[model samples]
Target: MADDLLLGIDVGTTNIKALVFTTGGALAASASVATPTERPHPGWAEHDPHTLWQAVVAVIRRALASIDDLRRVRGLAVASVGEAGVLVGAGGEPLTPIIAWYDQRSAPYAQRWKTHDDPLETFRATGMLAAPIFGIFKLQWLRDYEPEGYAAATTWLHVADYIAFRLCGARTTDYSLASRSMLFDLRARRWSESLIDRAGLRGDLLPELVVSGTRIGAVTPEAAAETGLAPGTVVGAGGHDHVCGALAANVRRAGDCLDSMGTAEAVFLPLDDIPLDERLFIANVSSWTHVTFGAHVARDRYYVMDGLFSSGAAVEWMRRLAAPGASFDEAAAEVETLAASAPPGSMGVLFLPHLAAGERGAFVGLTTSSGRAALARAVYEGLAFEWRHMLDTIEGMLGVRARTIRAIGGGTRLPVWLGIKAHVLGRPIQVLDMDESVALGAALLGGIAAGVYHSEDEAVNALQIRERTVAPDVALHALYERIYREAFLRLAPTLAPVHTALNDLEMI
Candidate 1:
């Protein structure tokens, strides 16, 4: 059984990756392909379901090619971005494209829903903040704009659920993924019939919900032939990518937190039960089910989550503007060299990373001597400041401080940024050895379904997770505490009216 392998497929915003790992947590092989996002109209984004399926197949086959004996692969599962999903027809074809989770095209629908319903009631039932990023709003958009497709659809499946359905012909969704739909009841752990009826959606449009790691079915012959997977290999359920990453990082307790910094960054903290307090709704924090059950240490747990829309995206934008034509490594090196030479706090420069609609990023207090390095450092500091502010809000609302914060994803590669974050937060950060935590978490679930591990703890113990702590600099932390309290904390409130005025002009 030492040779037994598990496969985890991650359907991310930028790429789709298939990672094969041994039961003991050593990676065996991996392959990745760009995730194609089509923008047919401004402010709208989508993924062609067929094209996505093809990419998944390609990555699976490409990764498995390195293995000597395919029989050693015992099980597979999928994890993906939440909220974005495709509606499927009765004949098992996608009725509509998978709408990108960040698409703003559904904003009008979300606004209409907010006008008709009490947002507090909705938040109480769904544990969501009633945003356009939720699946229910996307469904409403499709219902009105693409009536034929909406009428013909039999079920709606999240990205990971759709991939699993394609592999094994099962129509099911896990609780963690379903929690993002804005149609699920958080306390009842089921789709809300009242909300569905109020939204005028079909009663049966959603799939049956199950806990993560459940073995839905085996890989079908057709899928096996296409992807080089063994026929009848167990296919287990997976959940939202961030939740899976938390699982891999062992962030399963009340005080443990996972800082998943990728294209978008999420701060996830598990809770023992759902909090229906109005403070969470006001703070824009979401309460949702964890992707855990059945012998897991965090079984039947809930989590409070929130995030910045553009964390790594802001860094990538800076790379394009400041280090054009430079490789990412080259740009990163430049940033490191310049930042180290420059003073802390980027020499009085401050950046506000609001690169979304209605607001633009700004670099205030820049002097004639400020250069690209200073600008890059300011960006990192700005992000850290924002995260500290967010954490403060979360802790204030929940009355629970994050005892241990584990950092994961692409941003952890930047040592300077990690140090800045540690100083800004005035807390030590634990950086994990594993980069592919999301995929690894899904693979662990697959291992569970295959009987390779008896429980989540066993799977995690096998990995023997290694981490290094990034402790804060006391002197830098003291300085950052003052700057954050005085200037950075006031930026958003002072700029809100200006942003609103600009948005008004754009509308006109």
Candidate 2:
């Protein structure tokens, strides 16, 4: 009875999720398991690739075990958090632990790139700013610090690509994932060989290129035995989790954007043109290959992305500190209650939530008058301010102002937080009904590759996009504008000395 089901395995930083859906576009079953991130040393965040692979297999098997019949699965693909990857040795095994984007071990490497002349050229080629969060910088870190591991590696692969290779013996990566590496040529739709050589990286380390939804291969017999997939179950190419999540949220066409709120908050707009807009590049927002390329796209279409990296993480941290041992739902309720009573300015406290490893968050303008509720409200407002800042920066780059933003993921569940974002950004937030849009997007891609849908457009049209609009309170807009300009905007620069000291002491 379950024979026509499609599967989506989302490998996220906090957890791994698997969703099974019928061809009729109804959810059948879903399961998830924690995927722990390990911090073995200062400024390093990583996960053993072998253990990650085992977790993936176990999660997939557990999800499939609940189905009435294992043969019901038609196809599946992996969606993963961007910018984390590992290298494979000659025998096609992991040579090193996967370095997470949150890891700052490569911070110095990114700093060194600042001395390059005409930085716009690198941005034009890769569509990425020179940051440690990019995969190239992480690669440089590994090569410089762990030369043995680098030498042992025969191929370097992003998270989704490695899972794809495991399931189907295909060593290929999609453009959407490749674009996050700062090594892919946006115009060429391939790896930048010149940049690779310049970085002293082996040209052969990269995977073969593939379009996002193409059928890489069927589940191998070995994979089938390990997991519960049928031997012939299709495996399709997938990309970054946010891009895939956007696909399900219908973030296409001009002026369309998706606000995906997970541990991080991602805001990206589907762009039809890939002009190396020096202005946009200089603004520092990233332009990347979209997950689903249109039929007419010839290496020239992309999505412009900007985000609040610690948006959800900030709130979560505050919740734990404010009320230890409380569930997220319980903490969220408390924050909402307090935020509703508190004014828009968070009572003069400006919390900077972008503290790096070993660095604790700072609350500026704190006085003896400050209480826990004010601290909680400050965290909420800080996240909203960052979101507003991202919108301003990305809007300037894209030259299109969004009147409506489609929101998805866990953050959408909190109405109070959504209201704060809506008020701060001064736009109507269309919060989607589904919390698992990332999983749904992955299944959509798998369905396309399996011939269940004629094309990406058809698959998107079939998605059940139930949502409610959260409109901004006109009065709060003026109040937030003042706070954003005077308090939130001034705090970062004012604390530059603290950040500098933290870095110098090697404590952050």
Candidate 3:
């Protein structure tokens, strides 16, 4: 029983990681490698599928090397960044490079779709905003720019699906990943026929969809040889990396929320049913099927998700700008020390963290006395305020407040940031001790597929989750409450005109 192991491979934008865990939820071994992204042209980002596969293989082999018996590994699954996918040919070869989700090369196609289609109708069907990040737009980009490859492609597989296919020889995808494609019918839980027709894509371009945690197939001999996994090891369906991480954190019930802090941050709040509010669309909040399902969790559950494009990214940017050549930990430590010295409101300085296209980040009310400490503190406060804004918007639309906010990912390593977020939000932030929640969620799914656990509830119950709560500081909370409402909330609207003017200047 102790020998039974589950392997979870997470294909992230930053790194590819393989983690092994026992059925009882204790970590056994792990390995990771940086994910290589190619920027062939400005605004274009892609990953060679072959290179990604090799990285996955290398991590898997390296992780399994610590185990005594390969056959003890019962099941494996993969969780990956959503919306990025590769087109596969009839013979299981990649027809096109995997497009990065954040790439803006498909903007024209997305804009065209927005012009032609009713956005409300699109939102009702897909529960996502019209963005170039969606897989459908990337497919459109391929259809127009690389017609030959698009024509030859038989199936489009999400990053996780592609890796799983390579491992188990299955051409299938899971619902949570499919939801990110912007081609799925959220209510019907299938591909939207009208959207597929509108996009000028073959209806069959997508693969068969399965729920996350469903057993798909077993690792083939070829895959076993490449990854040091036992041949015939059961393979399970996995979902989007964020959803998988949420699952591991046990944010499955209605009213439960997860703040996934990474290169980009997202706030996930699971709901019992879809909210038919147009305001959610306007706010850029997405409602989609969560990785949660079964008799344990609500079967008809969805989640409202939105966040800052630059939560942790803003901090990283500051680190690079102010503490060049310093390691991340070193920079973070300096930031923590400096930020702690600054007062609750960052010494009257305000940071508007809008790092997206057409928007510029700014530090207002800066004086000669303002130093890196106040500037860094302002960045942290700004990130917290932005998340508060997003959460407030979601709460207003949903008519429900999150009862619990669980924090996960790299950003949680920053104690000062966590404390600032807690104080700013006026709520306790539960930081999970699990370092790799996404991979652990994948492992839990693998456990289900391998029959090591009977259900999602049982699999989750097996996890040894330990958490410490960062309670809000009362005095700091009051100070942040006033600052957030007065300064931080107005910062965006105040800078909108300037951002537009700057964009126009760039164009001229």
lDDT of 1: 0.85
For model 1, residues 116-216, the per-residue Cα lDDT tens digits are 88888887887766678888989989998889999999999999999999999999988889888888887888889989988888868899988788888
**Model 3 CA RMSD to the hidden true structure, in angstroms:** 2.9
lDDT by residue (tens digit), candidate 2, 1-508: 2258889889997899989877655788888888867989867889888788888888888888878877678778788988899999888888888998788888788778867534677877876667778888889888988799899888889998899889998888888888888888877787889888777788788899888778899999998898878898889988889888888787866678778998888777777876576765655534221111111111234787776677787877877886688887887887777777776677788887775433445788888878887887888788788777767767766578975689999988878788988888877899889888888888878888888777777888776667799999889988888889877777766777877787678743
Q: Supply candidate 3's per-residue lDDT for 464.
A: 83
The segments of candidate 3 whose C-alpha lies over 4 angstroms from its true place after superposition are 277-300, 356-359
Clashes of 2: 2
TM-scores, all candidates, are 0.95, 0.93, 0.95
Whole-model lDDT, candidate 2?
A: 0.79
Top lDDT prediction, candidate number: 1
Superior candidate under TM-score, 1 versus 2: 1
User: Considering lDDT, where higher is better, how would the candidates rank from best to worst?
Assistant: 1, 3, 2
Give residue 246's lDDT in candidate 3 (0 to 100): 85
lDDT of 2 at 370: 80
Q: Which pairs of residues collide in candidate 1? A: none
Please give the TM-score that candidate 3 achieves against the real structure. 0.95
User: Candidate 1 has what TM-score?
Assistant: 0.95
